[model samples]
Target: MDDPAAPRWPARATAGLCVVLLAWNTLVVPALPGRPASAVAANVAATGVLLAGARWSGLTWAELGLARRRLPAGARWGGACAALVLAAYGVALAVPALRPLLADARAGGLDGPAVAVRALVRVPLGTVLWEEVAFRGVLLAAACRLLPLRAAVALSCAVFGLWHVRPALGGLAANDLAGGPVATGAAVLLTVLWTAVAGLLFAWLRLRSGSLLAPVLLHLATNSLGVLAAAAATRGG
Candidate 1:
């Protein structure tokens, strides 16, 4: 007979909480009034929720891949990821078909300096930290413990796809030259698919490096570069 008093993995509870948190961040928050502000609030809340849940489930920072000892290595890998993203954006700019994605539909008030400042602050603080911390750090770690590595990566990638649904849809609104609904839907699908692949890569980095810093840096660099690239492209770079 087995002793029923021993502590076991909280797989079911974690999964449920993950679903709720993901839904709130992706579905609910996007629809709320105040776009960028709501986005910031949603991300912060999601991080707090994930951290609280991790503690409740007896998970440590290391288990979450948040060990700070690997920061140096993570920074190096992050630089590589950023370089690759910029190279890809360079290609997109060269190709006319891809350039449409970088079209600047944003309101025109912010100039180069303002845009750079916003990207510097927003990318690392609001976009990168909470996302990499929650997705690659907390959710990926939790899924890995519950499932095989391959399965965990796939599931986490799927969850990551879910995370971008609102943003993918929102992109259509921010696009000045977006076509009809069908085209918008297809664009959203492609965005989700691409981000899913990116999520897999981030998860791989997190697992291989055994540090959340890798994903954090990669996430931050990619987003910051994106903001800068968009600004430049819109200004005819």
Candidate 2:
């Protein structure tokens, strides 16, 4: 008989906590008097609560891939992969058919320098870390525990795509130009596909490296290159 007392994977608990926190943020926090401050506080509090839960569930920072000590070899490999992805993206942008799409993404008020700063600070350190923790470390890991590898990967990718649906719908709703809805929808569709592809890649990296650190590095590098490319394009324009 299977040992019923076997400890549940820490990832499962963390994913559940993330869902609850997301709900709380969406529902209760927004109703507070100081909405902005409440939102920030709620997020911070959620992080703290999740971290504590992780510890209690026998999860270390390493499990969540937050333990960054050695930085030479890993950084080198991650950088190379990022460069390759950027080159591919550059080729896509150079194609006349795709140029307009690239231009539209760039046309939003955020310029290259601003993008660079956001990638370096907000994206890599904040968004990437938090997102990886929630998606790869928590959700993917939990899925793997409960399902077969392929199923886990597919489910995780679906979840990741669904998470972005709201923003995509909002973009479609706000589209004003003649081809705005088409463009926005296309962009959103492409983004969803790209994120799914990325999820698979990141999953493979995590499994191969036996650490979340590798995937996190890969994600950071990808975001950094994207920011740099946007900046370069804006400057050229």
Candidate 3:
């Protein structure tokens, strides 16, 4: 529970800023002409903003899961997350029905150069670093200060789901209801649901490990798998 004497406005302001930044990152950035690059830049900027906001809000590194000593543990959890995702991919390959979600039409043939860029720049700097900082670090930490622990987790998870709205919209556009509108809707819902669940898992890891490194690694692994899956599908793997 929040301290009885702590002023509430700063926390509320921090949370509001996070939601706005997420929407801008997901929705606005993608539409910009510079895109990908601009998006990455924006993410980098967001990280700085979150760190500054945390300080302004008087939040500690420990509260945001940034304790240096716990980084190794976070890395281990990240490895576990990667393994789980990879195992899921293995299962998807064996089950045709699961292929649609993993190997969607959007998985278009991999462009080696683009993949390299994403692996090096986009995934690391933008998706993994920026998001984990914003969601798991900043947002969750602020929420925790304002609400009960469980409620805070849920709120952060829900925000995480909304943050993926653009991607889900892209997925819908790519499929064009080839799977039927109902199926498409169901798939989108499932995707968002999964994102929220992952957010919850990441938040738990951050809370337990006391370091954002764990969620960052897990998040990186998760995104990396998408890149790998695209490459494999393109190559007939």
Candidate 4:
């Protein structure tokens, strides 16, 4: 017989919260009053809300892949991944044909000090941290409560891909690289697909190392180091 006193998983609440958060991240935050600062603030606020909701939904830190005891293992795994990303970026920059891939218009105008601040400070805090916390930590953990781990990862990663859709749409409009409606649509689809694949890898890292730190470090390296690499590549041209 089933235990009559056991707490239920609250599937409805989890689904509702995920929906709200998904909209907040993809829609509301983008239209916030101030850019960069407002966006960062909104995301931080969202992270707190996610944690609080997770707690309300009876999720433990361990369930969220953030157990204190797993810190060392997570760090080791994360650090290794980060180092590999740096090395790959270095190689990309070193190779003439691969160098163009790193040459981005985004970092082309950045001065040394600005690049330093953007890469070391802003990207780490504003982008990587919030994203990993939101996707792999809260969302994946919440999904696991109702579905199997594989299904949970799939759902969370799908949301992560959709999370990028707004940004991708805005970005394509701002840049001439993907001109025309069909081209823009294609670019957005590719962006979603690529980000979804990246999200799957991040979820794997989080689960494999038993800590959110693993994905955080890798994400930090990919975004922050990629910025530096882009600056260098742009300067090289």
Judging by TM-score against the true structure, name the best candidate. 4
Quote each prediction's TM-score. Answer: 0.82, 0.66, 0.84, 0.92
What order do candidates take by lDDT, descending?
Answer: 4, 3, 1, 2
Tens digit of lDDT per residue, candidate 2, span 84-129?
Answer: 7777668856775654444334324476556655666656654566
The per-model lDDT (C-alpha) reads 0.73, 0.59, 0.76, 0.83
The superposed Cα distance between candidate 4 and the true structure at residue 54, in angstroms, equals 1.3
Which runs in model 2 stand beyond 4 Å of their true positions? 1-6, 9-18, 21-48, 60-77, 89-101, 104-108, 111-113, 170-193
- TM-score (C-alpha, index-matched) for candidate 2: 0.66
**Per-residue alpha-carbon lDDT of candidate 4 for residues 1-237, written as tens digits (9 for 90 to 100):** 012233446688667766886788777887889777777777777777878877776778887777899999999999999999999998999899999888876787789988998898778777887788888987777777667778889988888898888878766654447688888889999999999999999999998899999999999999999999998998898
Quote the lDDT for 167 in model 1.
Answer: 72
Off by over 4 Å in 1: 1-8, 31-33, 86-101, 107-109
Prediction 1 TM-score vs. true: 0.82
Give residue 1's error in model 2 in angstroms. Answer: 21
- Per-residue lDDT, model 2, residue 175, is 41
